[model samples]
Target: MSTERTTGPALVVQNLTKRFGERTAFSEVSFEVAYGEVFGFLGPNGAGKTTTVRTLGTLIAPTSGAATVAGLPLSADNGVAIRSRIAVMPESPGLYLRLSVAENLSYFAGLYELPDRRARIERALRSVGLEHRADDLCRSLSKGLRQRVGLARALLTDPQVLFLDEPTSGLDPVAAREVHDLIDALRKRGVTIFLTTHRLAEAEQLCDRVGILNTTLRMIGRPDELREQLFSKSIEIRTRAPLADPDEVFAALPGAEGWQRSEDGAYVLSVTDADTAAPAAARALVTAGADLLALTPIRHSLEDVYLQLIDTDVEAQQR
Candidate 1:
């Protein structure tokens, strides 16, 4: 777990597949995580997100395909080497309830055989803001604090690649925000993070890019890129009164592909480009003698893209 930086992708997966007996956990999944990038792994429950983390963490072997983790080839022989340079923080922190916070960390440090154990422990505790609670029993800590302890344990190795599985799965807003802040700080320090979570908003806010998986990778890109890929660019226009001949007005506008009246009595214009279409739409509205109340671009959230893709998968399976 040397802190020395590397020059290539922190992780590289090529057609990696895993199976349990006849059941396929995941298949033909491939992606790369760049150094210092926060790469979000998103999916619904039972979608093999954790399995993928475990496989990449060298906890389990893939059924087929290959991968490079922490700048080392993934294989039985290299498992030790790969693991030494990476850390996995599961949804549950899995601390010894009876052990004090510092004791729990010290136990794990021994497992890692990390030298300068005292200094590393201090630094890890400080990183997660748990230094003050070092002497407190883990059983007395809140769920959020325990999660921080788990994070501190993960940092004990000073991993090059950190895999986080649902880090804030059940945290309250206040606690989740604290974890979010810590993660943002880590990103600033250039720690490559592979975050798996069902929380779409968290992923959208924190991830540099995200990959949506449902047994297989459904999509992978930055939030905006995925939205543009899966949704049509559109502008929602609200007028004081409906145009008498909406079709006549919008049909003549450049960049507008089509128009529709929403159930809420607003006009939504499909466009090739919102920037180019907004001005044209405003001009068209004024010419039609309509007082425009609002002309706003429609933004699709990561949740929208996720649902659309997952729903499509469900429909395909039904067929």
Candidate 2:
């Protein structure tokens, strides 16, 4: 499915900071998430990711700064109105253990004061593929199933914005995939998603942009852009046979920063520019009588970029 980008950002945060007395949770965190965008919020625990979400969700107030959710200004006066336009599935499912799935959803639907509560409940359950288990008590469901039920509950209000905190945590592979599929479906419908996940793979697969927060806004951009910013281009070449002395060939290549061989015998060459260095490296290897099998640029994983950023931030703070 495709989304039209004509609409402005679904959420806008400008230097938003929140503090509790002397403790500053996060400071000057700013970003904008366009409509239909899945913006990933990532940070280590105590990094204030949750605080930022709570502030945006209107559960807590910001100390200073401004934001708008769905074009509505974020303030105490707008809290009730903002809640109506958004749904938050917190780290915990927070379902009533004794209640049936349908009952738990119905309870929240009532809180939202949604009309046609029964129809809305059914639709939400179906959205998460949990209609068959509607009558099952919440306690009886497994962790993954419980997660789905919580998701269904969040959807009952047909929220324009969704906040999911570790929505797939503790689920088996199959269940996690189910949640991922549901998230994909939501994005197709133009629902803005604010996701906080420790799973870098999931963030890489789903988020349109990511913001790293650690007591302050550290980095915010598309995953690829952040990766490129934090690391240089690299190229990997697999040879038909290992060269007698690979170091000499690699050292001769222009713009070659460093080189290493993997356990599988592929040469990983760090270069100033993969586009030009790749060809030169290939020629250098072939000239040395090494048969070439494959040559490809390497894209750093989000995890790699994230760790590097954290480390860099730590060192800077120390100095």
Candidate 3:
């Protein structure tokens, strides 16, 4: 329901770097976020995920390089304009505790100089399912509710780009789920979201693309693309009976790297191509007097890929 112009990418970063005195927070980070896309920024703590967000949101200037957010160049001269078009929800909700939910939102709306401030306030509250609690004092709300208030405040300006830094950090599972749903809804409506979090699963679930940052960018691509780049396709099959010499039997399958029995008793086969290997695996099993119960291609999880990359990087840095 935003009237903001949609042209090309919603955000673009080019070799962006930030530092504080002698310490470098992040360096040479670069990636672009397409309009209406949820771009997830992921890294371990101190990986400069938050620093990158701060730089892009115009909260802090990069030590070098440049970025254009929502078609506006990010610089000191354009900082005010850039800030106006983007809303940032920091890791902490940062709400005025004594103020009521409506009051907190109203204050932010006024800062944006929005016309019909009250209507926008109502809409923001409704968007986050806090309409019923609009009059409740922020101090009395649960942490989850306070987070929702933060989200509503972000919506006050109907920003073209929304930055959410650990939006669900401290909430219970139910509260986290609620926030996830709200984000999903916003994505469906074509709002661009820049999210940074330690939750790889959440990134896998919500982002159209993700960039793994750790002082520098490790990788940037779609979740499935990253998986494919880092792992081989595989297949898993359960048998009505135990596989006879699964290692040797499956090793003969097309592009097979041999097979191992999983803890669940399923034979997991590592192969170069599941498309060509699965059929051959089934045929080989049948010929070997094995009863194939179920055959499923192994899908690489985001966590698996993330850990592998992070561990590899850490080991290399140490060496």
Report, for every candidate in turn, its global Cα lDDT versus the true structure. Answer: 0.92, 0.87, 0.88
What value of lDDT does candidate 2 attain over all alpha carbons? 0.87
Best by lDDT: 1
lDDT (0-100) at residue 238 of candidate 1? Answer: 99
**Pairs in steric clash, model 1:** none
Residue pairs that clash (backbone atoms under 3 angstroms), model 2? none
lDDT of 3 by residue, 1-319 (tens): 5867657788888998898999888889888998888999998888898888888888888999989998899899999898878899999978999999999888888877889898898899899999999999999999999999999999988888999999999789899999999999998887899999888888999899998887889999999999999987779899899965777677667798877778989888888889999899889888899988999998988898889888988733543
Q: If both were scored by TM-score, which would come out higher, candidate 2 or candidate 3?
A: 3
* Winning candidate number (TM-score): 1
- Candidate 2 per-residue C-alpha lDDT over 1-319 given as tens digits, one digit per residue, 9 for 90 to 100: 1232335678999989999999889988789988888999998878888888888999898999999997689999989888878889998989999999998998988888889889888888888899999999999999989999999988887788899998988888898888999999899988889999988899999999999888888889999999989888889999887788878899888899988899988888999989999899888887898889999999889999889888878733553
Number of backbone collisions per candidate: 0, 0, 0
Candidate 2 regions exceeding 4 Å error are 1-7, 237-268, 272-276, 291-296, 315-319
Candidate 3 pairs with clashing backbones: none
Residue-level lDDT of model 1, residues 134-234, one tens digit each, is: 99999999999999999999999888889999999899998999999988878877788999998999999999999998888989999999999999999
